[model samples]
Target chain A: MNVFVVGVGLIGGSFAIDIKAAFNEAKIYGVDRSEDNLEEALSLGLIDYISNLDELDKADVVIIAIPVDATVEILPTILDKIDDNCLVFDAGSTKKKLCSTVEHHDKRRNYLAVHPIAGTEFSGPQAAIANLYRGKTNIICEVEKTAFKLQEKGMEIFSRLGMRIRYMDPSSHDKHIAYVSHLSHISSFMLGKTVIEKEKNERDIFDMAGSGFASTVRLAKSSPAMWAPIFKHNKENIIETLEEYIANLAQFKELIENDDFLAVYREMEDTNHIKTILKGIA
Target chain B: MNVFVVGVGLIGGSFAIDIKAAFNEAKIYGVDRSEDNLEEALSLGLIDYISNLDELDKADVVIIAIPVDATVEILPTILDKIDDNCLVFDAGSTKKKLCSTVEHHDKRRNYLAVHPIAGTEFSGPQAAIANLYRGKTNIICEVEKTAFKLQEKGMEIFSRLGMRIRYMDPSSHDKHIAYVSHLSHISSFMLGKTVIEKEKNERDIFDMAGSGFASTVRLAKSSPAMWAPIFKHNKENIIETLEEYIANLAQFKELIENDDFLAVYREMEDTNHIKTILKGIA
Candidate 1:
């Protein structure tokens, strides 16, 4: 099998490594605008060769793993260039825009819209790790729109990567992701911003931050190039979540300010159900 | 030496384990208001035996690892009952009020105002681990108020647990911690609450949450019994930090709402410096 991965950064680079491990005979090609990322991906052994869109004719599989805006802009073009037998898919965080772009294309069955639901705060080819998708969820949207053989092949790849698959519509995927993934990034980024602005002494922050603070703020380090587009693409759902989150913070703040310890205690105890909820995540 | 841990939960139970490991000959006693916790600590081998406030006369070292409000209420009484040569210390999160309560005590020299900056969301004797404090920070407030020999013994205990010590005044400690520690907890709890309220399907939350969401909401699972008191005692500083955080979130929301992707991108880019700040924490 011949595979081409677009935007050879964290997601694409990791996919290249894992897919090669799963299918040793498969030849992998890297495509990215950044020469540095291409070089890094090559040195890291994440790809078999560096290739371009002109070579799409030879690819049996083409995975789009770029920032969502870039995916929105270039997905239709990639679909137009790929061979009919090629099974093209995306690992973008948001799915609605990409699904809509290729909805009416002649080779629509060749394209599958997937949100692999995995990543780290770090980016770039250097951050790529093998088995990044292992034991993670892969949400496949509009699965019925794809051809049966291609869907079967995609499922085989997901299983080879050790992922559990779930199916949803593109609209539902966007809504749930806003609450579960995108809102988390915004909360963490704002948290880091608030602390850095208030606590000017970085030394104090370093000395006082326990593993709790580190875990809560870890997503603040995620790439803005990636997340800004996700937030923008899913703006309506994200805005609703952000407003609810802000309101919750305000209520908690009011309780604390009024010295209503009982109310504060009850609120936290109510939220403690998250313990049971998160146990399933791991 | 004889050591008594006043509250044998996460902090106290873990301390009992480490202190016993370091001082093999030391006799460790467990004291808590809950009989269930006492029994669990005994079964876990976290303490030599169950002891009470009356046993204070025999303890050469007394460690108060309770909620800050409980620490404030019970500290002076524990100080009044302990032997003159006993070295008493606390591992509470807040320091300002605890420092003020014992400011004029005749046995003030016997007390060490210490906050070993370590913990997880889980609590109770079952959560206790052998080296929870290893390679973590210990913030000692008003170290000058402690007598010389007792301070030496306290430092020795901290060293055995593999901690790096930093000294600060009690007021400064509470102020800085409000931003770094307390505020993180609030953000996490509220994030969890908002998601649970919005996402009615537990299965969807389980399926959709990536590691980032898990990390950001981890502290929502913390013991409300332990945290409520900390928030109540440090209400002033926490309220200030919460307001600032809310304002920051509102501004970010406005930027997103206005479709100003550039401003949203810039804000997250600025906060990305936290990646460097967190490197020094570990």
Candidate 2:
């Protein structure tokens, strides 16, 4: 099988690496708007060779792994042109609009809407690794819209990559993901901005940041081009998530102002439930 | 030299295990409010035996690695009871109050006010491991107030544990730490609460908490018993830092509401400087 992956950055590059390792006979073609990224992807041996996305004609499978806004514009066009037997899928975060845009296309059955819940703060083909998707969950929304055979093929690829599969409605995916994923990005970016603004003091950030600050604000370094569209497309859910995030901060603030030590302690202790949840204990 | 660590949790137990590994002749005495922790520390070979506060007379060094509120109350008492030759230090977040409360004590010269900037989200004696302190900074405050010989001993221990030491005034340490470390704890806890509160869908958290949310909210699992007092004692600085953090979030929110895509993108990209500052980027 030949796979053509556009937007050959972290996610796409990692997928390419994993696919080749899992299915040794598979050939991978890389695509990107940036020549530098394509060159890096080649040097990393992430793809068999560079191919324009126009070559989707020869692809048994074509994956769109770009930013959300770009995916909306490019996916329908790509879906329109692919061969009838070709399987198309998107690895974008906001899936509702993308699913809706392609829903009526004659070959919409050829496309699968998936979001593999995996990524690093790092980006580009340089950050790609062979097993980035291992043990992680991959959410497939509106699977019923896809041809059964295509869905089966996609599942085979995901399983080969060592991922667990989850099913959801696209709109519901956007709402839930806004709370879990988009909300995290906003919190981290704001945290970075807050510290950078605070760097007006004598100590620069390098001098002040330890592991704690580094971990909490790690996502602040994500691609603005990538995240801006997520926030834009998932605007309502993002807005709702942000309101809750800001409110929680405000409530904690009021507790601090009141010098309510017991309350502050209890609040933090209660939230320590996060440890259980993250570790899968909860 | 022999060393004693009270409250052998993540911080204390790590110090005990690492310091002994570096100095093979080191004898360690474990003391904790919990007998279970003492037993675990001994079983982990973190200490020679579980000892009492009175054991300080026999040891050359004593470390108070408990919560801030406990440290403020118990540390001075331990200092007063220890032999004049014993070197004492603390590994708590807030130092101004800890330093001030013991400023006039006769044995204050033996105590070194320290805040080692290293820890994982895990806690308890079970979390103790040697080498946790390696490659991390150990900040010592109000060193001039400490007796010269004991300060040298403390520095020797920190250096042998593979730690770099930086000195600052207690007041400055509290202010700067509030921005870097304390602020991160607040941000993470609030984020965890916000998502849990807003998203009635728990599976959303399970399915959508990619590495982004996991990293940003990592510190939310920190011990509330340990952190509550740090926030309470450093109440003023924490509140100030939080206000700054919330204000940054609000500003970003406004930029989003106004459809100022350029501003939103620019801010996120600028904050991306944290990558360079954290030594995270190549």
Candidate 3:
């Protein structure tokens, strides 16, 4: 099997690594706009060859792992180039836009839209690591849109990589993910911005920040190139969530200002149920 | 050496564990308003004996690890009950108010204002773990007000626990901590609240939430009893940070609403320097 992984950064590089390790016949080819990333992916042994979209016809599997905006731009072209038997999928964060981009394409059956819920605060091919998808949730959007055989092929790969699959429509995926994923990024980024602006003394943040602060702001280190497009593509849903988030913050702030300690305590106590909601999630 | 641990919860119990292991002659006496906590601490071997406030004069070292408001109410009495040679320190989140509460106490020389920047989202004696303070920062406020001998004793205990010391005035410590610690908690709690309210289906949060979402909401699981008083005591500083944070979020939301993707990208890119600032922090 020949795997063509475009945008050979963290997600793409990681998928290549796992596929190469899981299948003896899998030969990985890297395609990235950044020549430096392609070179680094090669040097890091994340790919067997550096190829371009022109050679995508030879691919048994094509994984689109670029920014969501870029995915929307090139997905139709990618679907046009792959063989009928080829299974093409994307690992973008926002699904509705990417799925809609190729809904009327001639080879719509060849493409699968997926958002694998896994990542760290780092980016680039160097940030890629093995077993990233192990025990992680992979949400598949519009599974009925893909060819049955291609869907089976995608499932086989996800199975080998230890991903649990949940099928949802593209619109619901985008809306729900706005709360669970995109909103988290914006909140983290703004939190980091607020702290960095207020505490000009970096040494103070260094000394005073505990594990809680680190955990809450960890996603601020995510790649802007990847996240900006996501925020843009899922604009309406994300804006809704940000509005809700800001309103919640403002209310909580008001409670504290009015010296309503009981209300503040109840607010946090009510949210403590998040522990049970997040139980068993990686 | 006799150690009286008031409020035998996560912080106090962990301190007892380390103190017991570090000094062979040290005896840990648990004092909690809740009998269940004292009983649990005894079963966990976090304390050698169960005692009361009246017996505090027998204490050679007193560790106050309760809520900030409770700490303010009882600090003076604890100082009065301790021997002149005894060392008393707190592990509260806010320092200015706590320091001010015992400012003019007759036994002020025996008290040391310290905030050990270490804790998990969980609480109670069952959440206690050994070595929680290893390689963590312990902020000391108004060290000069502490008696020379008692300061030496407190320093010895901190060294044994492998804690690095930082000295700041009470006001500055409270102000800086609001941005780093207190503000992070409110953001996380509000994020959790927003998501929980918007996504009524808990299964969706469980299935769709990723590592990033999990991390950004981790602090929302913190004990409400412990945090409400902290928000009250540090109201001004925390409200200031929240205003900045909410303003940043609102502006970012405006950028998204207007399709200003470039500004969103630049905003995240600029804050990426938090990576370097937070380098080496656990």
- Cα lDDT of model 3 by residue, B1-282, tens digit: 999999999999999999999999999999999999999999999999999999998999999999999999999889878887998999999999988888888999999999999999999999999999999999999999999999999999999999999999999998899988998999999999999998875565568898899999999999999999999999899999999999999999999999999999999999998898788678
**Model 1: CA > 4 A from native:** none
In candidate 3, stretches whose alpha carbon ends up further than 4 angstroms from where it belongs are none
Per-residue lDDT tens digits of candidate 2, residues B26-99?
99899999999999889988889899987678878999999988998898789878988989899998889999
Clashing pairs in 2: none
DockQ score, prediction 1: 0.85
What 10-residue stretch in candidate 2 chain A is worst by lDDT?
A200-209
Determine the C-alpha RMSD for candidate 1 after optimal superposition of all C-alphas. Answer: 1.1
DockQ of each: 0.85, 0.63, 0.89
Which candidate gets the maximum lDDT versus the true structure?
Answer: 3
For residue B71, model 1's alpha carbon misses the true position, in angstroms, by 1.0
Model 2: lDDT of residue B236: 89
lDDT per residue, candidate 3, A147-201, as tens digits? 9999999999999999999999999998999999889999999999998887775
Q: lDDT per prediction?
A: 0.92, 0.86, 0.93
